[model samples]
Target: MELHNVDLNLLVVFDHLLRLRTVSGAAKALGLSQPAVSNALARLRRIFDDDLFVRSAKGMLPTPLAQELAEPVSYALEALQNALNRKVSFDPRHSDRDFRLAMTDIGEIHFIPRLMGTLRELAPGVSVATVRNTAVNLAEEMSQGKVDLAVGHLPELTSEFFQRRLFRQRYVCMFRPGHALDKRTIRLRDFLEADHVVVTAAGTGHARADEILARQGVQRRIRLRVPHFAALADIVASTDLIATVTHKFAERSAKYFGLRYVKHPVDLPEIQINLFWHSRYHRDPANQWLRTQVFDLFSE
Candidate 1:
């Protein structure tokens, strides 16, 4: 493909189609007519010599070739947009950008409230959305722009991504204030013998706590398994079951639930929550500004 012969406008249409995944959806996203968008896609198919996307019951499904082109095209288009929209300084107070983040339930409960408070005061028009974090294929997700930033203890971050350590948190044992265990200092034997509620987001197969217990050849009988940290705190507050959770989350919810936190009996490694983003956005001014806000808010 010769640069002189290729129409740059086609790339814009391709990007819209890639994101919206349907001719009509692409038209809506790009403010073009459906027939016009379909014509552009036809031209793109001829230039690339591939169907690019296939019609499906759900929507237009990208072929392998189109999937391969999606990221580079989106990145290129974003860079062009930034260059064209360049100003001497960025004023978050006036900009209405939406930032999408991937975070665990713990992060949503503990960190987002403070972050949103800052945003509400500074950038009232800005929006924030959170998606659940997954341990599998995180790098690919970040690279594809499906998630703008990933905030959590991301043990699976790739070398290609940039990471900033936000804060370190350790595990703490939580129970209602009047529970029997609250009367005495928690010991390893007592912890092992007590009925517990384990918080498992994905499912109850294996977890960090389980690994720690296996290493010590001591296992606590899990009386129940709950999905969210907030729910676990709620259950622990009203029942005899004990919950081991991140100290930050436990402390944040302690007063609300009338619960008391004690040091976990077994030695557990501190979980370091970090902020991660793809290298492609490392130099983006808007992304940089948002990352700075996150770092400052969490660090403080």
Candidate 2:
């Protein structure tokens, strides 16, 4: 409990271990030996009088006490790091920082190509990795530094996160180019009567289209229900199924899939897609750089 008596280096090991959930991973990330990380963890357990993490087949699972300490410990470390490195310049062209992001499949398809193009031209040494937004605890992952940024309309990432609006997106009805409903003007009756490919992109704002329609007593003759947008273009391109998707996604994939999209006949609220990051990283130089690039490149 005495601050002066505790070693600061152990906290670094603890942070890495919590983020990676494995001693070997933590050691590799910290440039230390596995034994050193294990020894640091042992010391941490003795100091806290609790087994902070328990080894299991699933990796080092955090105990309740560790979970309780996660945020404050992470926040303190981030603050300390920012304070210590406030004046250190970040040379993106020379620095090799790996940024992890959380994104949906559509976001990866829509954003990665252009993002990589920009990165290759400016920050060639920097690497980027993406995980599904719904795959992990996004808030906890960002808080612990597992994911650096999450791009999408993720409503659950509020409270502890900071976000900047990127653009307002609306839904569009997409289908094969020569489909019967390909006319410039689409009627609601034709839309509702046609076979639809419903995309259940759960855990994202995109899924609300169906809910909104249902609330208005509008029903589509759904011929298929898919969980992701990755294959929607292919399915809709070959079938008579019309899909309701975000305008950007529909526009981006139309050329490749030989598809056409029209304005949704039924009215629906537009969704705001945003760039999100943990508030603790607000002052971190590298985090600031990455967020600035995303805002500059993607915002309308």
| Whole-model lDDT per candidate | 0.82, 0.90
Which residue window of length 10 is worst by lDDT in model 2?
Answer: 201-210
User: Model 2, 1-300: lDDT tens per residue?
Assistant: 788988999988888989999999999999999999999999999999999999899999999999998998899999999999878567899989999989998999988999999999999999999999998988999999889999998888779999999999999889898899998979999998899988888878887777898999998898899888888888888889998889998888777877899999998999999999999888888999999999999999
Q: Give TM per candidate.
A: 0.69, 0.71
For candidate 1, report its TM-score.
Answer: 0.69
Off by over 4 Å in 1: 4-89, 135-137, 202-206
TM-score of 2: 0.71
Q: After superposition, how far is residue 107 of candidate 2 from its true place, in Å?
A: 0.6
Candidates in order: C-alpha RMSD to true structure: 15.4, 16.2
